[model samples]
Target: MRNRKTGFILVEALIVVACLVALMAMLAANQHSSMRETQDRLRQKRAESAARSAVAYVFSTLTSATPNSVTLNDNWAQLGGNGNQSFELGDLTFRVQIIDANSRLNVNVATAPQLQSLLVDQTMVDSLLDWRETSTTPRANGAKDEYYTGLETPYIAKLASLTTLEELLLIKGWTAQKLFTVQTDVIQSAITQTDTNNRQLPLIDYLTVDGGAPNTRANGSTKINLGVRGVTLNQIVQLGLTQAQATQVFNRIPFNSFQQLLGVPGLTPIAQQRLLDAVTFTAGNRVTGKINLNTAPSWVLQTIPNVTLDIANTIVTQQSTGFTGLSQLATLNGVSPTTLPRIADSFVVGSDTWIVRAYGKSGEIGTAIEATVVLTNGKLQIQKWDRLNTIGIPAWWNWEEEPTSTTAVGTGQ
Candidate 1:
């Protein structure tokens, strides 16, 4: 009986030892997890700092330099053409880029046909429009508050215009892959693509809320509204038009589009510039989504109502000399009298508003600053600034990207 008792005590001691070993293992795992969590938090904070600092740097640079116009070849876009110069704060790396905002499609004011050109399904396009309208009424293919509220997680439609591109993900059918880049197999199978490029530019690259500006001239002067009151023939002649050309264009009581006046036979560049400086079809001072013909890529150029892919390519080819005024546009081969009236109002030679994007990464985490910049009083001023966390780093940069449209610029602190 004593020997039996000894054996029982020995077994109890073994069980105790096993329990201690298990406890030690649990403690060790918990400590490791805690350390990982701490590291992640630190990295996040650093990323946030990096984003804000980059924005501040851009703001300061613009304020001091005060560029009047932002174009594709400007130093701001090139970052002094120095790709090696980058912000390196410990392990974080980033870059800063200035994009011509007007060189994109403005979804807020785009017509239904224009929206359809984005290759979005009619349902998604209708839903995107429904989300922006003030009313709760849903389109035939769109969702209102009801559909959104019935979702598993339960959310509401924005019921207003989007302030950021990130808000697109909240829309019914839009996804990160659709907005930023096309990288995943799931996306490849989901959306039927018409683009044949090895790497297609996403819809976000061609869309923006702040893509255009108020119908103001590059000189900050209000353009005369020929749609309401007619300017005198003297005013037309003073703009460098000959008496016959002036009378010919001026006889039209009210001009509808700049093309109506600009498309006159043999109008000089100076005359075209003056007509642009002095007239607009829009009566009121509302914002417009006129894409800059001087700086737009072929992708953005093709978004014009009647611009075919070949026409867009032709225009890009002629951009070597740059269109200082709309006069040069009429001289292009594809621009016919019949085509001029249809597309004249959609293009502009000068642009003021731009997108200043600062983005960077640390390990796998990414951050970005998207700012709407406008040139005011010969200085760059911030219109809207947004700091976005969890931004996906653009993949087209190193993937032999067609162009730098997808190149990510950022700053680090």
Candidate 2:
């Protein structure tokens, strides 16, 4: 009996030992997981802080510098330039890019011709017009409230300017995949060319609605300032003049009136009529929403009446120091005198608004902040702010993972 009791007690001791070993293993695993989670949280927090700091830095720099001296290409060289500027704040590294908002089209103020230049789909263009106009009547291929109400999850058409680029998804034909694609090579031929890659250009990259309501002419329409100084000869040729006639027009400058062009020898009646229809001599040069000569793309420049591809390219390349005055553009090699008066009212020397992108990274965690800011008379106002899960970071970072979340950091009117 004594031997039997001793054997049973030994078996009980073995069972207790096994249970303790299993419990210890579980505790060890829990400790490791908790440490990893804590580290991830710390990194994310640091990244967010770094991103905010980067944005602040850009705003401070812009505010302190002379507005006319700040060019999108020069101030934010990393955006499209060969080199990148990055700095470390403790363990977090931050990168920033600043772009002129005037470089993009303002949907609230864009004309049909201007919108047509950017989108290959006439239907999409008409649909956008229909979406913004107060009329219930639709254009030939446009969508109205009736079209949207017929969807699987019915909604009404927003008869107003788009508050966000994502609002296009609610329209008839736009989708997330179609809206964000990049068109690396875009061929601009005509408005109706279906083979063009303009459809692939992301709407977010080219449109804005926030920079204050544009100034309206007495005719109840937005006006382009044509007084911008760099009127090229090609732009003048587009005004119905032959190469010889345009050259004659190029030699003259600083015309106070269209009547002044009559003094140019061999000014034909047809050329005079075309010039009258296209050119405006009013000193209303301070119109709101004019494209910044310092940052507008060559294609956007081509949309101006007289600017051809070659002339537009020349204008972009010659603006290394940025045009402090329109007169500076008049000095380019091929600029025509006739082009100056016609386009004099169309451009601004500096920009009042800018698009700022700031990226922050800490360890494996990263975040991006995109903000649209308006700086008028040195007062800075943030119109839009978004936090992104993924952004095109510099190649040196070796970041390959996809973003985990996309959330709005904040928004303002």
Which candidate should be chosen as best, given lDDT against the real structure? 1
Query: Which residue pairs overlap in candidate 1's backbone?
Result: 94-410, 95-409, 95-410, 96-410, 359-409, 359-410
Q: Per-residue error at 52 for model 2, in Å?
A: 0.6
Q: What is the lDDT, from 0 to 100, of the residue 336 in candidate 1?
A: 73
Q: Give the per-residue Cα lDDT of candidate 2 at 168.
A: 79
Give the TM-scores of the predictions, in the order they appear. Answer: 0.74, 0.67
TM-score of 1: 0.74
lDDT of 2: 0.63
RMSD of 1: 5.6
Q: Report the C-alpha lDDT of model 2 over 135-219, residue by residue, as the tens digit.
A: 9999998999888898889988889888777687777656665456544433456322111233323445566665431232322
User: Which regions of candidate 1 are displaced past 4 Å?
Assistant: 1-18, 64-68, 80-86, 126-160, 166-198, 213-223, 230-232, 247-253, 259-274, 282-287, 378-413
Model 1: per-residue Cα lDDT over 1-413, one tens digit each: 99999999999999999999999999999999999989887877777676666666666555533232334555455551222245665677555666777777777767767777664467768888988888888888888889988999899988877887678788887777767774343322132222324355556767787765446565446766667655787876876778987887776758667757666676666666567556677776444577877677777777677787778878878776566545556567887756765786887766667777766556666676677987665667788987664445344221221223322344321
What's the distance in Å from true for residue 289, model 2?
A: 2.7
CA lDDT, every prediction? 0.66, 0.63
